[model samples]
Target chain A: MSFDVNQLFDVNQLFAEICEEDNLFAFEGTITSEEINTILENVEARMAELQIDLKHRKKIYNITVECIQNLYHHSDMVPEPLVEKLGKNYGQFVLRRPGNGYFITVGNFVLNEKIKFLSEKIDKLNSLSSDELKEMYKFILNYQKLSSKGGGGLGLIDIVRKSEHKLMYRFYPYNDDYCFYRLDIVI
Target chain B: MDTLSIEGTAKTPTVRFDASKGLIELKGRSIPENSIEFYKPLVEWLESYAKEAKSQSTVNIQLEYFNTSSSKCILDIFKRLEAIHKNGSEVAINWFYDEDDEDMLEAGQDYESIIRVPFRMMEVAAG
Candidate 1:
């Protein structure tokens, strides 16, 4: 099967759709390295929109990059011919100003079987305190033994640790074989 | 043995290390397109710095945030610094964290506990 590049991707439209709502600052289509750069540029531009200092901007920028990359790396679409022909698998990310801090949401499709494991992992992560999370991260780093495409077993742990709030996620059925997983990390 | 300084971008952090001044600073965000490529030079510079560092050196880390891959690179940096410190030169690491940012503070403590260098945890007012 082939997907039209134009129908599959529209960077500006995605950005506008994400930023159109009140309190929304920026957005990006498909979390690739190039997309990451554009997101960073939009973030630099929106620093003034959000009226935040350079340090805050820096932190937010880092958090957004981490969040987006997680989406890119952990997305369910694999190295398949169709996805490759489509150029990229699109994931949605949004950063919204929520009072004192920003709320970040990144979502992409995942295989149905992965949701249970991910949910269980998040539940375990959610149960831990910061210190416990650190300990768990260390243990995972030393013992997890399996490296993702990014060579780190600590992505979810890092995301949970960085965000002040609990990691929120949703799973929506995309088809019989896959479901869309949305992960939210508020910074 | 050589000093390296790079400007901080929205996605990547600013890195400044002067072996001559004994001051190494890593500031800004770090989520490089390729974490290995971005950090390779910095790690190599540190390896050389460790070999030829002066009597005492202090590395200051003021990263607002970093990704998981960058976290690994950071651990590698800290381990190298620890090695340099063990070679009889005084090494002190100061990690600056924003007030109320328990995450960064805890991360600093984690690195401190793991590495053998003398690490000081300092709090700076959040921006």
Candidate 2:
């Protein structure tokens, strides 16, 4: 059997690239519920280690929970043809402290058809003033039946309200029918 | 209707609903991935209790945190309770939020406005 030195170099390069943007933590792969548990605990522990105030720590934790679980509900597994090329079911989840507040970035594979709905959702949410967002949140809370995903867009609203900022989003075409949806929540 | 008590875990909340005593208490964090599974029974219990209630019920919610899915289920419970209240049964919901947690307080207020089941927001010492 021939040893592949270049493959090792390629793997190391990938690790370095992931580490470049997020020195704190970066995860890319299947995010089972069990994985979410461990990731949350580790994040909590890290925040404690950093001596972050409880309130700030919890805000970070809550936003992270919503972002990752958004994966469980929204992200489709990479189709078989794309698995070899894509590496995982979802895109990378990076938590980093670039300057002041923490940056949480999560990406996943979403059907191209969903782009309009998602983009419009964010656009409408962004258009609202803080007061309007609260009213809209309550209005949706009162009327909307829980979607099959078990939430009626409350995750997005919560993310916006907690961060108190517009969501930064990007859709990179993954293939003919799917696109990689990346969301950035800063807090 | 009987009392329903479910112990809490890192991911789920503790529920204490005693029909006999007219006391309903939900404390601890509720972030269960399948909130539907965790909250369905409680909602059903409230539905059943609403059928044969003879006294005032007090619901005490002192949650540190809960996720979006749990929010829907929580509202379901509140709506059921509102039905009970509308049927001439006295119902009071005391929403307890940590003094420092405005998000939780706002959540309780949002529920209060929508449920019509008179909510009292109380600031409690952080636990």
Candidate 3:
């Protein structure tokens, strides 16, 4: 099956919807390592203007780094077909403040074949309590080899632990070849 | 051998590994996209430092924030130090976190649990 490039995930439409609410910053396009640095700088500047305490601000910033870098690392795993259409490392992220806590939503494309593993990973992370997650993080840190793409399989676990919230995720079927993976983290 | 000094950037940390004083200080953020690449020299330097045999080695890590990838590389460094400490070099790791930053403190404690080297959790005033 095939899907229109725009139909994969409408970046502009997503931002428009989020902006109408309480988005502090939003970006949708190719995310390079350099771009990640720029995005983090903007996030830090934006967070500085808020009334958040030091701990919360660091939590939000650390989570933001993991979220965006997750998108960046997963870019290589996207099927060649999707990479051609979306460009390598194409991803989007929105930082919003709705009610009391801040919301960070990061999205990227994943090959269909990898969906099961990704889903199971997130589900397992969401199932664990805070203490369990902490133990898992330490275990991975001590044991796991850092992937060539620069992930220790600790991003999702760290996000869940630091946020102290269950990770919210969805895998939207873009086509038979790829699925849009979105992670919504509350901080 | 000689001292290893690398300036910090927007995404990487400032690394200073001095062999003479047996002082290794890693300050600033450590969120480089390619953490393995960024930390390779420091790890190699530590490997060399291990052989030279200073009776005491002190490592001060005061990172404002580090990504998960960097976290792993940081652990790699600790593992090397653990080996050094096991070999009878007095290795002391002082992990500095801003006051009230429980996550950073916990991160230190986690490493302390994993590695045999003694770790001192230092709380500093938030800047």
Give the winner by lDDT: 3
lDDT of 3 by residue, A94-180 (tens): 988899888998888777887789878888888888889889998889888999988898988999989988888776666777777
Please list the Cα RMSD from the true structure of every candidate, rounded to 1 decimal place.
Answer: 5.8, 5.7, 3.2
lDDT for position B70 in model 3 = 95
Second chain alone, TM-score for each candidate: 0.95, 0.96, 0.97
Assess every candidate by TM-score.
0.78, 0.89, 0.92
Winning candidate number (TM-score)? 3
Q: Where is model 2 chain A poorest over a 10-residue stretch in terms of lDDT?
A: A1-10
Clashes of 3: 0
lDDT of each: 0.73, 0.80, 0.85
Clashing residue pairs, backbone N/CA/C < 3 A, model 1: none
Distance (Å) between predicted and true CA of A84, model 2?
Answer: 4.3
State model 1's lDDT: 0.73
**Predicted chain B of candidate 2, TM-score versus the true chain B:** 0.96
Docking class of 2: medium
CAPRI band of model 3?
high
Q: Tell me the tens digit of each residue's lDDT in model 1 across A8-87.
A: 33333444654665546545345676776777678668877767765556556666777677767765473243365334
lDDT of 2 by residue, B52-108 (tens): 875799999988888888898999999999999999999999999888778888899
Candidate 2 Cα deviation (angstroms), residue A9: 19
Per-candidate interface DockQ score: 0.40, 0.65, 0.85
